[model samples]
Target: MGGPSENPELWAFLESLHLGETLSGTITAIERFGVFVALDDGPNHPVFPGVGFISIPELSWRRFEAASDVVQVGQRVSCEFLQLDTWNLEARLSLRATQPDPFQAFADRNAVGQKLRGHVTKLVPFGVFVQVANGIEGLIHLQELTWTPLKAPSDVVQVGDEVTVVVTQIDRELRRLVLSRRQASPDHL
Candidate 1:
């Protein structure tokens, strides 16, 4: 037995066990639960086999309403293995997990005044969740969502809409990412 990281060949072999490792594979089957990825790893690999599963929560690095929208049968994707159980032969992988944080890049790219494109993920009475990039979610508070007088934030934007936003604040210590749609779009006012 070899440590997962130590054994390059074994690591590569184990990585091929899941969907995200290598996108080159056929969708051997699809079921109500999830799609299956057929790899050249072994013979007789079951379609929806074993305890290994990529739950909806683990599917994306960012928050999404529907899992199916992000993935489908016969789609190729590269992913990073989060965990694996040799005993149970279970593997947990993530497509975005393997990628670097966009917010970090945002912070690096712009000091403060830079603009970014963000998609609405959640709408609340107080604010909205905007995905600036994969694994990077910024909050657009009711006050920040719009400059106009609004009774509710949802009036300005609905979930899944892409809007331009300005980086108002980035609190890495508190893990807070703040953006202002109002500032980003002055014409909207």
Candidate 2:
């Protein structure tokens, strides 16, 4: 099939929208992969259901179980224009852009070696997710969970267990926060 370049009208419409600009639209469809939006000002998409598209990751800044948890069909929403999705024949949009990034806010106020207390949110083979702040979860790798040896994170901590952790690394660009429980211990020094 042809791309947006072949459809001059859609191409012009998509190009008219600058990145980070706010666009209003109605949620036309929600799929496992992304959400579709019928832009209030753009032409109808020649292929898809809508001229605007929001990927699953762009739907929210916080973790969610599903797209429906953050938005529903027919919901009027404002999104930040991310780019022209020529491959998908739609304008890529971001709902998360319209909201403050909790991770960024968390990073700005905290630094490495800082101690934080939060409950365990999840356990995995390699690490545990701890919510150090609202909508912000830091990963404590199995090696960092404690100085002791363990076969799994569950061996030491379970979901909802409150624990003190020290921020080990903050990768702002990647939006990752690494934590260490072993260092948080008073005797670690």
Candidate 3:
């Protein structure tokens, strides 16, 4: 065990580990594995001084489909440390874990009956996956794609097509967002 004053560098790092410490760092690189960031200079380097790994679950605001989506070769980001494995020299950082869930933000902005515009990302026999936001996705079921009976969602909407939709239900517990394009344009029904 290291005493605080005896090791100023270690002491500073431990002090900064206190809950709610906000850190800003520059993304040094974005690999298929995860994003690497170098802590802004002071005492603690955002990159963990001598350590080299920052877990993928920490990037803020968006759920990265892949590491590249959330960060590029060079980007600046503010993150909160979730945990540090000093023994292994690993630090877990998070952008989403520290902030309020953005789904709640969407739910707050739009109600069950509110209309929204989204782009269709995929078409399945069961429904279409529309990307409402980078991390947020809403499902438009085949039945909800249109008021009229349809055998497939592709018949009504194709991938990359933008369409208006109405939120029919939001399952916050399950993080499921249910939307209906038919309800928004009932006249077309």
Leading candidate by lDDT: 2
Instruction: Tell me the TM-score of each prediction against the true structure.
Output: 0.54, 0.91, 0.68
Q: lDDT by residue for model 3 over 83-120, one digit each (tens)?
A: 76555444456766667888878777777888888999
Candidate models: Cα lDDT each: 0.64, 0.91, 0.71
Residue 68 local lDDT, model 1: 69
Higher TM-score: candidate 1 or 3? 3
| Candidate 1 per-residue C-alpha lDDT over 1-189 given as tens digits, one digit per residue, 9 for 90 to 100 | 335454454445555664445333444444545544444343332224422345565565555556566777666555555566553344555556666665567566665666999799888888999988767888888888777777887787889898999988887565578888899878855
Evaluated at residue 17, the lDDT of candidate 3 is 69
Measured on C-alpha atoms, candidate 3 has an lDDT of 0.71
TM-score of 3: 0.68
Error of 2 at 101 (Å): 1.1
The 10-residue segment with the lowest total lDDT in model 3: 44-53
Q: Rank the candidates by lDDT, best first.
A: 2, 3, 1
Best by TM-score: 2
Candidate 2 per-residue lDDT over residues 39-77, each given as its tens digit? 999999877889999999999999999999999999999
Question: How much is the lDDT of residue 51 in candidate 3?
Answer: 27
